[model samples]
Target: MSRAVLWTKVVAGGLLMVVGGPAFVEYIRPSDEELRKRYNPDLQKRSAEQGERRAQEFDDYVNKLKHWSKSDKSIWYAAQEELDNKRAAIEAQRAQAKEETRTQREEMRKEMLGEK
Candidate 1:
């Protein structure tokens, strides 16, 4: 080639390298997608373990509340009141059933004796 053309080409090539070097390095750098794929399973396992721990903590708190209901007087009283109400309802039903049975028995006795 001509000397002028050779020098011009060399200077142009050097200028291109200088301008694009940093961008070229960045383009060849490993991507976040590759790094993320490596750690994704470990991240999911940690997240799931944290969720299970949170669930266990919630269950423990609920169990504590249940124990407190049994031990603490106010909570015990509330629970006892509920139990008392249930017992009262059951007793009331039993009394009604007994009254009904007695009535039916009396009616049968009267029919057998021809009293009414």
Candidate 2:
């Protein structure tokens, strides 16, 4: 085949696929209204129940977040500050224990050498 004819055929085939692919899928798949009309009652009930449960869970989550935000500041920033405060407290305690141990060790060494 000539180069022009070959190129034309390739371009035409590509366009046909880009347009026809979605059309073919649309023709095969059922629309939402048709699917609803053919829906089973038991399945529909379960789906609705699941949706309600998810909505309730989301409400509970939001309420819990509101309860946690006692201050008028940004909730996320407040939470982060609380986390940082806890970490600082823990580090302070660790440092205090280390200092106490060092003092005790010095006392023991002085007593062993009778240095008083």
Candidate 3:
């Protein structure tokens, strides 16, 4: 090919790359929601499951507490308190997870809507 034609092809190829690279990346890259769901799926279900397990544990502790003697009541009460703390911690964790998921979904929605 002539030098002019060769240079023209090179310029065209460079232009194509410059314009297409970002478009290609955007096309192939997963959206934020997709990435979140892929990495942290079943958030509510898992939280529910954890809550159920904690409830069951609390129930077991209560049952044991009922059967214990007056002398052992102190220990049982302490155990019950510990369970309460654990339940509180779990609730806090669930709330934080939900908030994070909500924030992420909101951000993704904004991105899809072309909002800044």
Candidate 4:
């Protein structure tokens, strides 16, 4: 190529780097906050699912209690004991669920992977 054309190509290449280099980097590199924000919808959906599961579990427990109460007095008393046991079981499950949620939150915090 002629000298002027060669110089033009070099200048064009420099201008392309100046303009496009930063844009390419910006496109590929995600900030921590941006990543977390991107995952917000997934986190919300999971939270809603967990809430629904808890509500269903509560409804099932209530239904079981109601069924247990509709029996003879002795049976009702026995059912009461069973109901107490179920309540205790539910309480334990709640505790476990809380612990699991806490653990998840902690892990997300450490990884900087959460929405909040």
Evaluate all candidate structures by whole-model CA lDDT and list the values in order. 0.84, 0.87, 0.82, 0.85
- TM-score against native, each model: 0.37, 0.42, 0.37, 0.33
Off by over 4 Å in 2: 1-67
List ranges where model 3 is wrong by over 4 Å. 1-73
Please give the lDDT score at residue 60 for candidate 4: 92
**Rank order by TM-score, top first?**
2, 1, 3, 4
Query: Residue-wise lDDT of candidate 2 within 1-116, one digit each (tens)?
Result: 89999999999999899998999999999997787678799977787679889999999878857866877878888778878999999999999999999999999998988963
Model 2 lDDT-worst window of ten:
64-73
Candidate 4 clash figure, as a count: 0
Model 4 Cα lDDT, one tens digit per residue, 1-116: 69999999999999999988999998899997776577779896786679789999999988977776685556568677887999999999999999999999999897886554
- Candidate No. with top lDDT: 2
Candidate 1, residues 32-80, lDDT tens digits: the string is: 7665567779896786679789999999878856866787478767667
lDDT of 3 at 13: 98
Candidate 2 local accuracy as lDDT? 0.87
After TM-score superposition, the amount by which residue 27's alpha carbon in candidate 1 deviates from its true location, in angstroms, is: 42
lDDT-superior candidate, 2 or 4? 2
Clashes of each: 0, 0, 0, 0
